[model samples]
Target: MRAQKQEWYASWFNTPYYHILYGDRDYEEAGAFMNNLTTALSLQADSHIMDLACGRGRHSLFLNKLGFKVTGVDLSENSIDFARKQLEQDASVDSSRITFDVHNMTLPYHDKFDAVFNLFTSFGYFDEEQDNLNTIKSIKKNLKDGAYAVIDFMNVPHVLRHLVISNSKTIQGITFNMNRRFENGFIYKDIEFTDGGNKYHFTERVSALMLSDFQKYFDQAGLELIDIYGDYQLYEYDKFNSSRLIMILRKQ
Candidate 1:
């Protein structure tokens, strides 16, 4: 049977809350998250950074404001367009250093960056695990000799501990609903959206890949796991206490 999680976001996330959840997101929390985490990784001031799967340029713009040369890449043309529009309206401290565009995360990039970031559980999308590996391969190709990559992932244990089997919310006159259920290390999400006589629904499932799984993928992609953080506060990752896992990786 087809999983309920794949279409969950697609069907329900195109609304205003979708933009709030994914695109048009304010990264104050996430930017601070990146700042402290990158500091821990010893990121330089003028580093060339790539925000992979960057929706509406949250992290990209954040780093740009912080004086890093940043490139925001994503597969969503709609989101990219929105980001471009937003960037045009904002006055940047280092305007020339920021760029946002559409790109597939699963493919190789042209040049190397000092750092690469995939944040907010935005890394996983494909149905197959190798699909995720392809993205790791792309990241490996995008990093320079000494730079690193960081992935902000959810704490699987926390999710399991605080698993809400179902939930719902409203945004912009649209009713957004979600149902989450896990089986065999996969969290299946079923989502539905309704707005003014129109309705949509889809399913999406993400593998609750463990730290060991991250090790395997990073090793296979010629990347090394140098550090891991538990949350935005930049604390050490513990199985039960942390709500997220932030991993810092380097090319091997």
Candidate 2:
């Protein structure tokens, strides 16, 4: 008998435990990258931007604060809901300038945005390789001519070199035990956590894609890779040691 395969992100991303596990992520670091990226793009205050696969609209909100009209979209209903709530609570944010929606990245959106962003390794979870290409094509379809895109992903080589097999952490009284492995060209993380005497489990799998893979996909989608960065600080990409592979692409 074959084992059942599920879309891990759909379940895990919507879970409260998932947010708890990652709540300590560095916002200052993320904000610095967003700042540098917006400056590099030289986008106007009125430019429309799409935050594809935006989780909770953190980056989208920051971009909006910087004066861009932003739309943040995510497949996770809970995440979108949270983002909307956050937006409502912030009185300083112009409601008309920012919006959040539930969306699947593989679908088309048409020419509506001056820029599109996929940050925080928010890609590469589809079961079919074609779906990944479909996502790139959708990004292209959603952009106006000469519009730009930013994709922030893990550097496969760097991750493989620093892979930690197992670890445990306790957050908010919940103990999370995690195990990691690389198999069949995918890195898998298995998470088991206990909260309030209840045990929950989840897994995340991401394809170990190199720069060549992205170049091929971008070419097929009619996007030109304009620049590559190694980290949030915008250093030149070093395939051997970079902590991240951040590519800036432009739609032709």
Candidate 3:
């Protein structure tokens, strides 16, 4: 019998090295972005929010602190476990207000939510075009009528213009050498590192989807694009100069 092939994200995200490599992500900026986003949406207190593809519950916990009930879901079991552990250790957190689960983004979550957020370039990882469409459809399925969903994606053109082909970073005593390239409508990053005398390699591949591509998916998914922003501050989207492509969609 042929063994099942593991997906890149499933293998890479489950490893402890993934967290160690990206542990320095800016929490303050993320919190500020969340504040801006929630305020813009005019979310009322106690609104139920879903953090789709939430890793380690940073945004989920913050949303809970802002008085919203939050559900954080991710495809990685290890990530969900870490999030649950964090919630368990925090005595100040209201345990009932937030929950985490392992789930595929392409599948419809059982419960609908007032708002769903997929942040930090979390979309476009699937190899199949249908998977991308399915993810949008699932997001629409998870939202109540007239409810909002945000998809935070990287601006492919801008990123390509500024792409650093090779770089190295030493974090937590581990040096990760990364080589990046854009080919065949996908951005590929090959990461190599050595730790405890063992060498490891991983690759991250994301479809280089543009605004027009997303609009097509949104239309097919029966969603309406309500707004577009370039950055976490919610600036107007500019294709040439924007750092990010943030789309706000409403279930139709």
RMSD per candidate (Å) reads 3.5, 2.6, 1.8
Task: Please report, as a residue range, the 10-residue window in candidate 2 with the lowest summed lDDT.
Answer: 1-10
Whichever of 1 and 2 has more TM-score, that candidate is: 2
lDDT of 2 by residue, 1-252 (tens): 536565779999998888889888887887888899999899888899999999988898888888889999999999999999988898877889998989989998644799999999998998889888999999999999999999999999999999999999999989899999999989999999877778888999999999999999998988999999999999999998999999999987
Worst 10-residue lDDT window, candidate 3 = 1-10
Q: Using Cα atoms with residue i matched to residue i, what is each candidate's TM-score against the true structure?
A: 0.89, 0.95, 0.97
51-78 in candidate 3: lDDT tens per residue?
9999988888888878899999999898
**Candidate 1 weakest ten by summed lDDT:** 6-15
**lDDT score at residue 80, model 1, on the 0-100 scale:** 79
TM-score winner between 2 and 3, please give it. 3
Best-performing candidate as measured by TM-score = 3
**Model 1 Cα RMSD, 1 decimal:** 3.5
lDDT of each: 0.79, 0.91, 0.93
